[model samples]
Target: MLTLPSIYVLDICVFVFKNIDKFTRVEDTHNVNTRHKKRLCAPFSRTKTLSGSPYYMAVKIYNKLPNTFKTEKSPTLFQKKIKQYLIEKCFYSVKEYLEFCPK
Candidate 1:
């Protein structure tokens, strides 16, 4: 799939899964009952084409972002920064991004 070349999309998400706190500020929340308050995550579209894939959604979202969010820091830092940037823009992690994108 074309998305394979653009692995950053999956990398960014995997990073988010590995380090969810960095994105949600779960540490900052004051909730006592729940452990964390998840942000407004969007599920990957389920259409027939690549347009429904998380790769497509991620690329589309990244392309639309401003330069301010396009920092070239370390891979770890870059992921964290991108997470914050996306959250600020109201773009959440893929709610149900399966292991592979369907055709």
Candidate 2:
């Protein structure tokens, strides 16, 4: 039951990543080349509460996803993968989900 929110948040992240083009890749906005270029650029936040805004939370969660999950091109496959992953992990909170390190 608790995992439902994590699954829902993951779905929202997937939607923003696949459908919304406003979020820029880390590589696009920076000059110093980094190996992890696929990450989304997290917007600046004035406070911790502001950092939890939908846009910021979406990027944070999306960035933490496995590379394979992030690269999935098909919406159905992405949803399937995320749902399977969340069910297996059974994350109870957004913070726990954020700190997950998939094996």
Candidate 3:
């Protein structure tokens, strides 16, 4: 027969498992793709951090900007505009931006 302490521990475990199932059900319908869409829709997506490394974040941000603003003819200007936008969005400090956007 199980002791009182053992029964209490089992009860707590069951409660946690049930809550976990509920949370998973709620999150499954709105997975990472849905979150990504919501992030993109937000005005601050360009400045937001990616799930991976800073390089990935920079590339993702670069890809999201309008093509008209990212012509090869003026790559420096394009980069400057992106940096300015990130700063305006209050994503990070100038130091952090430099660390993330290394040449």
> Candidate 1, TM-score vs. the true structure?
0.33
Give the TM-score (vs. native) of candidate 2.
0.84
Total backbone collisions for each predicted model: 0, 0, 0
lDDT of 2 by residue, 1-83 (tens): 43667766767767875765888888888877887877888898778986968888888788878888878888888878887
**Candidate 1: C-alpha lDDT:** 0.44
Q: Alpha-carbon error at 71 in model 3, in Å?
A: 2.5
- Model 3 / residue 97 / CA error / Å: 12
Which candidate model has the greater TM-score, 1 or 2? Answer: 2
**What is the per-residue lDDT of model 1 for residues 12-75, given as tens digits with 9 covering 90 to 100?**
5444445444333323455545432333133445666867665455544443334444435465
Global lDDT of each candidate? 0.44, 0.77, 0.38
In candidate 3, what residue range of length 10 has the lowest lDDT sum?
35-44
TM-score of each: 0.33, 0.84, 0.29
Q: Which lDDT value does model 3 have at 8?
A: 34
